[model samples]
Target: MEWAALLLLALALCALLYLLGRWLLGLDGDLTLLWAEWRGKRPENELPDKVVWVTGASSGIGEELAYQLAKIGALVVLSARRENELERVKQKCLEISNLSSKDILVLPLDLTDRSSHEAATKTVLQHFGRIDVLVNNGGRSQRSLFVDTKVEVYAAIMELNYLGTVSLTKHVLNHMVQREKGKIVTMSSVMGIMGAPLATGYCASKHALQGFFNSLRPELGEYPEIIITTICPGPVQSKIIHNVFTEDLSKSLDNTGDQSHKMPTDRCVRLTLVSMVNDLKEAWISDHPYLAVCYLWQYAPTWAWWLMNKMGKIRIQNFKSGVDADISYSQKKKA
Candidate 1:
């Protein structure tokens, strides 16, 4: 009887110590990453010669992803609205990799144009026969208060960011479903997981993506070979800030914030690829302390709300001062 009592006491003490360690030592993140690694939940298949279709490949993370994938021997399909920029990216990819121009198809795509998705898919399949992965990395950003923003702005963002991505995925998904093996990778933002100031439409679109993909995951359970990965990155150094939409749905060209502190685009893409290779269902790729905010939002809702409210007020003040008010997008330029 004494031994049994002692054993119970020891177990209780261990549990208490673990909880303390998780809180005071902040070992939760490391422990979680370790567990994921131990489970071997990441994709183990090598990427050589695999056909990867990347949207928004003209610049930023998508462009970097294409170059890296090509270096690893993946046949990359580069897509965006600018054919010239796509060609430039293709050439750069070719220069760095052993792939020929024939291996990299420069496919011009406008995400808002739903009518073009069918032909786009057909063209991809005609060239590569099959798509092993589809990376949906194209979308716009918002930088206006919900009250000041036009209704059309919301629709425009939803059309391009949500519906357009969904439409393209639908076209490609049919082929993936038939093949019984494929990957769907998307670039959602930290805003998707938590709301932020001057990002009502943007947040809504990302949140919608989260819902759509999460619901779609269970339906694809029959096809164990198919994997869906959602990457949520926080404040990466990219042209996204330059392309933010305003109240009138106009592009803001004025840059704001300290981008030097943000994660480099190359590093962001590298982390995203690592998550993809691991076959993570959802992952946050950020160099900043944004992961802590994600955790707080998830576990301590009231605290997150209070923090966001404070941040939102600061953002509003910045906007009013015209410090970061010029966040907008223009036509794609040749890289």
Candidate 2:
């Protein structure tokens, strides 16, 4: 009887491990985020009537964010460098959602313009009375190898991606502090958590953001109502490839390649909304093996480094071949 019980237990353990492995294979986000999406507060219930200020509102994830927020009945503040693009996005929001023209504000903002951020914050306050959620999504990506890249490119990336984000956060956070409540969501990348070969500057900037917000969250313990959330999405379908900085400040990526393999933008935004409403400190929204690598990075540094080195070689090779650096390893090699 004892032997039979032990065999059954071993069989159950093996079955459980098999099930866990299968589940892990299909996971696109970190465990906490999936939990929130499953059981936490829904964005529709939480965001309605709230004021959300989205930077880079003109295109890519920011544009999608405006649409989703509008659909959910949140007062939207659309901001980007181009007034025309912001207006276009605003028009689309109005057409798709029940939001009136007054509900969607087209406020053109150049995030790199540090001097203008203060005025931008004041304008949102004047219009909305209070800011509920600030989405910092404006930033560029890098595609060149560090040795070939100019120092000015690195400086420009930091100035825009890191410092510009921090500048705006300072102003909006002040307002949140006054109210003792608000959510600051910065769109960081997976590169922030783990280093890659080609995006040295971009990685540094995101790492700075991760470190900054991680520290800032602790300091804001006095204002427990204020939430600082950093979202690290691996790769989503977007036009970011077309806008990546190359070896020189004056140069641009030659071949954008096929970005179809990336996760859908709307799906990423949906997960983001879930993370936001739940006040998750940090969420990794990515499909494996990127998602798998993040886990390895946290729990097994040596193994993660070994895997990254192997993947980084492929990434660098892809870039050199004038294709997307992050194209699927099997697909690239097969082709």
Candidate 3:
């Protein structure tokens, strides 16, 4: 009986110490990231003059990444559904850097069209001879309960977010494998790491990405030169919220959250570039408290779930209120 009691006491003490270390000493978040940074080596191949293909390059982080890569002298290929916006971004890239029209190829692509990925890859290869880095940043977001969300909504998001990314990666993978050197950078999200409210389909799609890339990472052991970086960034100021697909398969333009807290797109892309340059396997880029949530999900899952549940309820309430307001306004306008 005394031995059992002692074992229980020991376990309790260990748990206490771990919590204290994680919360008070800052052991679980940036410190862990710092250790990773210290241990990581910079990629042997520099970014300059490298052929870097960025998808969803029309706006937000993708557009910012294109400009930054251009500044670094990379031959940037911009792809997205918006040809006009892509041309604008291309012009911006050219203005910011010494790159000319020939250096920055604007290849407008619809990620949902999986059949076109091979042709897109061929076009990129034909233009640049080879793609040194492929950034898979094209995806859609969702904001609705699973029960309320249409079945087709789930399929659409999964097709765009998961299958589309996978198809593009496959098209690029063959080229990377043949050359035995390349980098695949994927834009995941905090929702990818853990569950969140009103993002059931979105979370599932991001989780699928995590599983797919992580499984693929180990299989490429023979090719150490090839690197795969998955970036899970917390809310950054972007059109993602405005573009979020709702239960009825309509886009939400409510602007429902406090933009003050969101990180700037440029800042997010800068941190992501640092991770890419360092060849970090995975990175969660965000402000302090938000970035700390990833660690909470990792080290203290039960607590994380409780916190998320509370937050989820609040978000759902806000969403419903916003929807009600919109309906009332529309009715008044009709009257």
| Candidate 2 weakest ten by summed lDDT | 326-335
Per-prediction TM-score: 0.84, 0.95, 0.84
Top candidate (lDDT): 2
- In candidate 1, how many Å is residue 334 off? 30
Q: lDDT per residue, candidate 3, 1-335, as tens digits?
A: 99999999999999999998556433212443445445654332468899999999998889889988998899999999999999999999989999889999999899899899999999999999999999999998887877877898989899999999999999999999999999999999888998877888999999999999999999999999999999988777776766777887765546555444456788788767767887888988765444666789999999888877766676677667764212221112233
Q: Which number leads on TM-score?
A: 2
For residues 1-335, write the lDDT of model 2, one tens digit per residue. 99999999999999999999989987889999999999999999999999999998888999999999999999999999989999999999999899999898888888889999999999999998999999999999989898899999999999999999999999999999999999999999999999999899999999999999999999999999999999999888887778888899998888998887788899999999999999999999988788889999999999999999999998988888877777865322235
TM-score ranking from best candidate downward:
2, 1, 3
Q: Pick out the ten consecutive residues of candidate 3 with the lowest summed lDDT.
A: 324-333
Q: After superposing candidate 1, which stretches have Cα over 4 Å from the reference?
A: 1-45, 323-335
Residue-wise C-alpha lDDT for candidate 1, range 195-237, written one tens digit per residue: 8888899999999999999999999999998999998887777
Misplaced by over 4 Å in model 3 are 1-45, 256-258, 323-335
* Model 2 clashing residue pairs (backbone): none
**CA RMSD (A), model 3:** 7.8
lDDT (Cα, 0-100) at 245 in candidate 2: 83
Clashes of each: 9, 0, 0
